[model samples]
Target chain A: MISSIGRFIIGVFSSTGGVVILFLRTLYWVFIGPFQKKPVKLESVFYQMGFTGLRSVLIVFFVAIFTGIVLAMQTAYQLEKMGAVLYVASLVAISLCRELSPVLTALVVAGRVGSAISAELGTMKVTEQIEALEIMAINPVRFLVVPRFLALFFMLPCLTILGNLSGILGGFLVGVGSLNINPYLYLQTSFKYLELKDIYTGLTKSFVFAILIALVACFEGLNTTKGAEGVGRATTRTVVISFILIILADCVLTSIFYFSNM
Target chain B: MQRDYSQEAIISVRGVSKEFDGRKIIDNVSFDIYCGETFVIMGCSGSGKSTLLRLMTGAIKPTEGSIIIKGKDISKLRTYQLDELRKSFGMLFQYSALLDSLTVEDNVALPLREHTKLDEEIIKIIVKMKLSLVGLRGFEKYYPSQISGGMRKRVGLARAIALDPDIVFYDEPTSGLDPVVGGVIDKLIKDLSEKLLITSIVVTHDMQSVFRIADRVAMVHKGKLIQVGTPQEIKNSENPYIKQFINGLPQGPIDFFKEDIGILEEFI
Candidate 1:
């Protein structure tokens, strides 16, 4: 049992280490490659950001709102029996600000954006478009992955902020309307409990999660073997790996936050 | 052997060999492809013909020897340098390999967008001209999945000619087409080569295509070029392997099936 646990820990660290190495390599190539002197494909980047990021807003908003409402209902019902219903606002605010917003947004992005990245790139690799790019003296990583990585990196934090706001708004509606809590008091409590550190921590986690999703998806897509079967495998691996990494990073960040104050 | 009077050579391969997993695929292959000529590499299945093409195109490094493309040693070039060298050659794969997410115009414009400093308007014009060249002028908005195989091949041809590459590699360009479509593709290949004055290397077992399009045909057998001649010369050659291959005969140096007793008896 102990050996299995040790092996699991080692596996996680190694996978994360591999992702880190790929991220560093991507950054190195981005700065040093010849295309750095060329003007950025501003139009392409804007289109991709709109396609990959803006399209994701509806899903994130719905999930956050639903999660917040559900958590308020459950927490208010449970705490009311003990005359602690007022604390439900603090619970919802703290949870959404510190953990749920970033992690849930990542999960949603993994399902929506990460899968698309893997499939798009995997198909490109299969079709030899990547080879065509290389032959044309264009770096596939710069032409393809850099735009995607930048898109996710910039947008994940934005999404996380949107997610947190929507979640708190959902909690406010539930607390004031359904739970019969005062609106002004609920807002004051949520603000008092949710510190800047909590918001910063969640955004930091979101940024890391964004990097992890983009790196894993791009790496798997770039290295896809076999063909169509290989693409399906790469897509599955990207989502599963991203999901696990986001959750794990959330835990670590949460623990850091938990212990630092203690 | 006497050298045929023709245009100057653009690509020269000398003593090139490639091995995969300890198995020799292309061994001691040597040939020269001339400018503005349609050179066809013909061979039986599993005869290392495609491997030879890959080595010549710098898609894969040769295990031994060198391939010089227009006086540059491709094997000695660095990765980016190799990429720069490869810009001069266009490759059309057996599958059309059109990017599925991209429309036909975008697919055709990919090379221009990647390599040139041309404005979008000029790129679009060039793409239109290329598509019209391949007879795909109005299908610019369609994706690969939405098009038929022949249309896809036309789009592939359009993209192949996009950058006006000095050399074009067509790997079985007529493989999966009907004979009529295949003949049209053959005519297109011939016309395109003559019009652009570009070197073309077509790898196929299609005899009809060879006779229709090839300026010179080279037959590969057991990882060696057994014959390199004009189509007329190939037809008239008395080499047994060439005779057997061109005729599609089961007998001679090439085996059509295994000689296992049960299978042999069942066939009989």
Candidate 2:
């Protein structure tokens, strides 16, 4: 029993070390990879961006708009009782800009894009395609992982911004059409309580979440074993691990940014 | 069965051993493969043939000793240096390993596009030429999934020889095919070896494939090489293990059952 517990601890540490090494290698390849004979293909990066960002726009838009509407409905009810219903706009905007849009966008991507990355790569691993790449002198990390990494890094913030705007519009619609609040007053109050720092904080969190999702997905995919069943397990693990790490990162960064603002 | 010393040795495995989880997969084994010859490594399923092939290709490092390709120890080379070395080698996997995302032409053109500065027209011509060489000329626009298994393997071969590599490695080149299709693949392997003068190393258990293409055959048994000789020499070998493997014998020195000490004592 003691030996089994020791083995479990060792397994966790070694796995953590493996992920760290993969992260470092990815960063090194990103900066120094262009000078290599087989540089990261720009076409591949563009393709990844299209898939991870452009294809995902409609889903993110709809989700964000709904979240805004729900936030306004809940907060407006309580604020109406206190004769401060105008504050619902501020509440929705603050939640969307400072927290909801980034976190929710990341969660959506972790479920959709992260799972796809893991499954695709895991299939490649089992099929000996990854080995074939190594045999051909191609760095799989540079060839496969870097493009996804850059795509997520460049697109997540843009998606978050789009989501934030859609969310505010949703809140505005709710205030004016449903609650009979003045449109001008709702618009004014939405920006009245929000600042550039809030937007910046959300975008920063998004960028970190992008890295977390990409790294975990690629790492799990590359380490996949046992064939088809293994790919399924890796895809599932990518989603679960990305959720845990993204939330943890969000908490830590929020704390730091909150303290700094104070 | 005497080796031709005049021909240059392209790859030399010197006392190589490989282990996994404290279990030895390849024991101390050494052999030299000459340039422009088809060397076949043959064994039963659990005999570590694939592991040995991977070690020679520098896809995996050995646990001990060295695999020297062109006088460079592959085990000692850094990751980038290994990548540089790998440019001279191409490998066709068992399932063909074609990128499902890329069309056949794109797959064949991958090496040239990545490693060379040739213009699009030049790459197109080269892609056509490579495809034609493997009889995949008009199937350029098809994805791997759209093609039959044999056609996919042919496409894989076209891609493997894309950069005009000095060497090509094939893993189970003829497995999962009917006899007629298998013969066609064997002919292609021979044709490529003769025409391109590229050194070929094939890992397979197919006896017919072994005799049809191999200039020299290495028979592996339980992670050790039992014999290395010409195909004719291998067929004539008196080694019981080789006899069993070659003839597909049900009973020989290769025991089918693993008996405990007590079980063996009872039998005695």
Candidate number of the best TM-score: 2
What candidate 1 gets wrong by more than 4 Å, as runs, is A1-25, A34-36, A256-262, B1-8, B259-268
Which tens-of-lDDT digit does each residue in B1-268 have in candidate 1?
1234476678999898888998888888888887678899999888989888878778789999899998988999997778777778788888877777789999999889878989999999999999988888889899899989988998988888888998999989999999999998888898898889778899999998989988899999878889999999999999999999999987788764646645879988
Q: What lDDT does each candidate get?
A: 0.86, 0.91
TM per prediction:
0.90, 0.96
Q: Assign candidate 1 its CAPRI class.
A: acceptable
Q: Considering every candidate listed, which one attains the maximal DockQ?
A: 2
lDDT per residue as tens, model 1, A1-262: 9999999999778866877777886786557654656444667778778977899999999999999999899999899999999888989988997889999999999889999999899989987878766655567777788888888989999999999989988998899999889999999888887788888988989999999899989988887888999999989999998898788878887788788972
For each model in turn, which proportion of the native inter-chain contacts is also found? 0.46, 0.86
lDDT for each residue of candidate 2 in B62-133, tens digit (9 for 90 to 100) = 999899999899999998788888889988889999988899999888888878899999999999999988
Q: What is candidate 2's CA lDDT for residue A252?
A: 96
Query: Model 2 compared with the native: what TM-score?
Result: 0.96
Sliding window of 10 residues with minimal summed lDDT for model 1 chain A: A32-41
